[model samples]
Target chain A: MIAAGLDPIAQFELHKIQELKLGPIDISFTNSSLMMVFTVALIGLWLLLSTRKAALVPGRAQSIAEMSYEFIADMIRSTAGKDGLRFFPFVFSLFIFILFANLLGMIPFFFTTTSHIIVTFTFAMMVIGLVVVYGVWKNGFGFLKLFWPAGVPAVLKILLVTPLEIISFLSRPISLSVRLWANMFAGHILLKLFAGFMIMMVSAFGVFKGGLAALIPFSLTLALTPLEFLVAFVQAYVFALLTCVYLSDALHPGHH
Target chain B: MTYLFDMFGYGFAAAASAAETVADYKGDQDGGAAFPPFDPTYFPSQIFWLLVTFFVLYFMLSRIFLPRIGSMIEERSNRIADDLDMASRLQLQAEQAQSSYEQELADARAKAHNIGATTRASVEAEIAKDVEAADVEADRQQAGADARIATIRNQALKNIDKVAADVAAEIVEKIGGFTPNTATVKTAVG
Candidate 1:
C-alpha cells in the first residue's frame, strides 16, 4: 500500500460555499453540509414517489422503499423489542441518511458526510441525548437502576460494578460515533491511495513499460470496491442497531 | 492517542471537541491547510444541516410513509383470508351435492328391484296354470283309447268260438253219421 502525493486525506477537507459568521462562530455551509442536504432530499424523493400509490403488490421502486423501511423497522423490533417502536421514525431516518451518505460518498468526487467526526458525533450525541431525556422523564429514580443490576451482590454493586456500568453507559456515544467515523475515514483513504497508486504506476512507466505493473494496483482498487460497499452497509447497520439498543435502555431501564 | 481520551471516559462532547484539534495528514496537498474534517470550524454548518434534514425526514416518514406501507400489507393479508374462506365454503357445497346425488341413485335402484320382483311372481303364476290344463287334456285322451281296445278284444273272442264250434259239428256228422247240438260243441271248444 504505497501512498504518495495528492494527499489522500484532502478529499475530506471542507470549503465554504457561502460563509456566514455570527459573533465568533463560522456557521458557513460546506461540502459536508451540502452532502447531508442532498442525502435527505434523495430520501424524501424516493420515499414519497415510491409510496405515492403504496400498492399492495409493490413495484420495484416501492419494493426498495418498503424494504428499507422494514429493514430499520425490524432492527428496532428485534433489538429494542416491540415497545421500542416509538423511536422507529428517528432510527429509520438516521439509518437512511447515514446509509445514503456512505453509499453516495463512493462516487468519484462526492463528499462522505459520516466520515467527519463532528458530524457522526452529533448524531451520537442526539441518540445519547434522547436516552438521557427519555430515561429520566420516564424512569426517574429507576434510571439510575441502569447502572445497578438486580442480581449483583450489594457490596459488589456499590464497590465495583456500578462504576463499571456507569462508564459503559457513558461510553456508548463515543464508541458508536468513533467506530463509524474511523472506519469510513480509513477505508476512503485506502481506496484513494490505491487509486493514486495505479495512476502513478501507469504514468511513471509508459503503457508499454508499466502495462503489466499497473494492473496490480488497478486490481487492488477493483477488489477493494466491493469490500468498501460491504463496510458501508455493515457500519450503517451497526450504528442503527446500537441506537436501538440504547433506546431500549431508555424504554426499560435496568432490564438488561 | 485520542482513542485513549475516548477510553478514559472524557464523555462524548469533550472527546468530540478534543478530536477537532488533532492535525490529520496535512502533507502539503493544498498548501498544508488544516484537514477540514478534524478542524472545528465547519462543525456548526454540518450540525445545522443535519438537524434540519433529520427533522424533516423523521416527520415525513412517521406521518405519511410508514402508515401507507402498513395498510398495503394489511390489505393483502385480508384479501388472502377472504379467498381462503370462499374456497372452503365452495368445498362444503360440493360435498353436499355429492351426498344428495348418491342418495337419489340408491333410491332409484331400490325401486327398480321392487318392480322386477312383482313382475316375476305374476309371470310364474301364469306358467303354472298353462301346465295344469295340458295335463288334464292328456289324461282324457288316454282313457278313451283304453275303452275302444277292450270292446274290440271281446268281438275277436266271440268270432273264434263260432268258427271252432261249426267245424266240430261237421266233423262229428261225417265220422258217426250223427249231428251233435251246436251249443254243446261250442261249450266243449271254449
Candidate 2:
C-alpha cells in the first residue's frame, strides 16, 4: 500500500540552488552540483593539507595520501599493468568522486550525484571514451582485436563471435552506469519506504499498538542503513574496477 | 441496479487514469516521476560539473599531488638503496679486516715457530761443541795417566832385575862359595 503523503521518490527531486542561464541553456547549479563541488573541494583540501610538508618520511596525512595513490596505482597495475599509468589521474579522480558522492548520499538530506544515470553514464562514457581514444591512438588497427581475441577456434571465428564481442564492448557504459545508479537508487528507495512505513504505522495506531507494530519497519530501516552504506562502497568499487578492466583491454588489445 | 453499472464504470475509469499516470511518467516530459535518470534536462548541468570537477581533480593529482608523492617514494627507495649498498660495503670491509687479522696472526705464528727452531738449533750446536771439547779433555787426561802408569811399571821392572842380580850374588857367596857371574845374572833378569 502506498504511504498516504510520504513520497519515496521525493528525495531524488532536484531543485536549483542557484539560477544562472548562459545563452538559452540553463547552467543553473543544483544540489547535485553543490555536492560535486564539495567533493572536489574536500579532496583538494585534503591533498593540500596532506602534502604540505612533503617530508622524506611521510606523516599521517601524507601516508594516507600515499596509500590512496598507491591503491589506485596498484589497481591499474594489476588490471592494466604498467601501460595503464597514463590513465591514472582520470581513474583516480573518478573513483574518489564516486566514493565521495555515494558516501555523501548516505548522509541524511545530502544529494547523491552518482545516483543519477546521467551522472554515472557521463563518468562511464568518459572511461569508455578514454579507452577508445587511447586504444585507437596507441594500438591502431589492433584495437579492434580487443573484441576479436586471438586463439579462438576456427569454427567460432565466423561473424558470430565478432558481433557478440562488439555488443559486449559497447554494453560496457550501459552496464557500468546502470549498475551504480540502480544500486544507489534502489537502496535509497528501500530505506525511504521502510522509514515511511514506520511513520505510517505509528501514526495510524496509538502508542502500544503502533509502537509495537512499527518496530518491524523501524528495525529493518535501521538494518538497511548499514546495507546502503555497504552498497555505497561496493558500487563505487565496482565502477572503478570495471573502469580498470575496460582500460586494460584498451591498453592491451589482442591479449585479452 | 443501474447504480452497480455506474460503480463498475467508475472503477474502470480509475484504473484507466492510473495507466495514464504511468504513461506520462514514461514520457520524456519535465516534472515527471524521479525514477528516470536519463532525463535530458539534467544532463547538461551534470555534464558540466563532472567535467569541471574531474578536470580539477586530474590536474591536481597528476601535476601536483601524485608527483609529490612519487618523489617521496623515490626518495625512500633511494635511501634504502644507499643503506643497502653501505651495508654490503661494510660487510666486505669487515670481511677484509678479519682476513687480514688472520693473515697477520698466521705470519706471527710462523715467525714464532721459526725463532723457536733457530734457537733450538743454536743451543744444540753449542751443546755439541761443549761435549766434544769435554770429551777431548777427558781423553787427554786418561792418556797422561796411562803414560805415567807405563813409566812406573818400567822402573819397577828395572829395579826387580837389579835386586835379582844382587840376591843371586849373595846366595852364591853364602851357599858354599858357589858365586854366579854378574853379567849372566843381569842378562837373565833382563
Candidate 3:
C-alpha cells in the first residue's frame, strides 16, 4: 500500500475531531464538517464586511458582493423569468455555499465538503424536492404535463416520450449531484496524482536525476492548478444554472 | 521509433499500476475499510452539519444580506431619478428666466425707442412754432416802421411848402416886391 502521505485518495479521508452520539447514531463532527462551517463563516463574514458601509458607489469588496448578487439574479432572470426571483435567496445560498466550499478546498490540506457524493446529493435532492413541491402546489395536475410534452403523436407520447420525460425528470437530481461531485473529485485526484508523481520521481531517482525528472509532472501540476480553479468556479456556476432551469420548469411546466 | 514506443509503454505501465493501486484500495474498502467519501459511516454527520450550515446561510442571506443590498440599489436608483427630475426642473426654471429677461429687454428697447421719437417730434414742433412766431413779430415791426416813415414824410412836405412860400416872398420883396399866398404855395408843392 502507498503510504497515506502520497496516496491521492487520502486527502478525502474524514477525521472526527469531536465525537457525539444521538441514540444509536454517531454524529461526530469531522474535518468535512469543519470545512463546511468555515465555508459558511467565510461567506457570512465576507458579505457582512463588504456590505457594512453600503456606499452608493461600491468599494472593491462591495463590488464583488454586488456582482455576485447580480450574476445570480441575472442567471435566474434569464432562465426562470422575473417570477423566479422569489427563489433568489435559495439559489444565491446554494451558489455561494458551493463556490466557497470548492474554493476553500483548493487550498492545501483543506477538506472539500462538496467532493463527497452525499453532500452534493443532499443539495440536489433539496432542489428537486422544492421543484416538485412547488410545481404540484402551484399547478396541481398540470405539473404532470412536464412529462407529456406537446406536439408529439399521442401513441408515441404514451409509449416512449412520456416515459423518457419521466425518467429524465427523475434523473435531474442524480445528474446534478454527480456532475459537481465527480468534477471536484476527479480534479482533486488528478492534482494529487500529478503532485505524487513529482514526489515519486524525486524519491525514486535520487535528488539530482529525480528532481530534473520531477519537472515534467511538476509543470503538469502547475498547469492543472489553474484548470482546477476554473473547474471549481464553473462547476458552481453550472450547479446554480441547472437549479434555475429546473425551477423554471416548476414555474412554467406547461411549456415544452 | 523504439524510443517513442518505450515512452508509450512506460506511460501505459504507470497508468496500469495506478489502476492496480485503485483496485487494491477498492478491495480494501470491500473488506470493511471505508473509502472516506463513499463510506456510509460519515453520511449522517455530514448531512446533519450540512443541514445546519445551509439553513443558517439561507436565513442570513434572505433575512439580512440580500435585502440590504437590494434596498441600497433601489435607493440609489430612486435618488438618481429624483436628482434628474430636480435638474430638469431647475433647467426649465433657468430657461424661463432667460426668456422672461429677453422679453423684458425687448419691452424696454421698445419703450426707449418710443421716448426718443416723442422727444424728437416734440422738440421739432416747438422749434417750428418759435420760427413762425418770430416771423410774425418781424412783419408787424416792419409795417409799423413803414407807417411812421410815411407820416414823417407828409409832415416834411407840408413844412417844405410853407418854407418855399416864405422864401418866394422874401425873394419877391427883394426883387419884384411880390409874395404868393402860403395856401397856394402849399397846393403847388403838394
Instruction: Go through the candidates in order and give each one's C-alpha lDDT.
Output: 0.81, 0.81, 0.88
Q: Which candidate number has the best DockQ?
A: 3
Candidate 1 pairs with clashing backbones: none
The sequence of per-residue lDDT tens digits that candidate 2 reaches over residues A92-179 is: 8888878888998999888888778788888889999989999999999999898778898756866678778888988889877777
Extract clashing residue pairs from model 3. Answer: B172-B177
Q: Per-residue lDDT tens digits of candidate 3, residues B7-108? A: 334334544554565577788667667666678999999899999999999999999999988887778889999999999999999999999999999999
Which candidate leads in lDDT? 3
In model 3 chain B, the worst 10-residue window by lDDT is: B3-12
Chain A superposition TM-score, candidate 1? 0.95
lDDT of 2 by residue, B1-190 (tens): 3643443343345335434533554553455544345556767887887888889888988898888887887888899999999999999999999999999999999999999999999999999999999999999999999999999999988888889889877876698487778897677666
| Candidate 2 residue spans exceeding 4 A from truth | A1-5, A49-64, A153-155, B1-36, B73-122, B162-185
* Reference-based TM-score of each model: 0.73, 0.81, 0.83
What's the number of clashes in each of the models? 0, 0, 1
Runs of candidate 3 exceeding 4 Å displacement: A149-161, B1-24, B28-30, B139-190
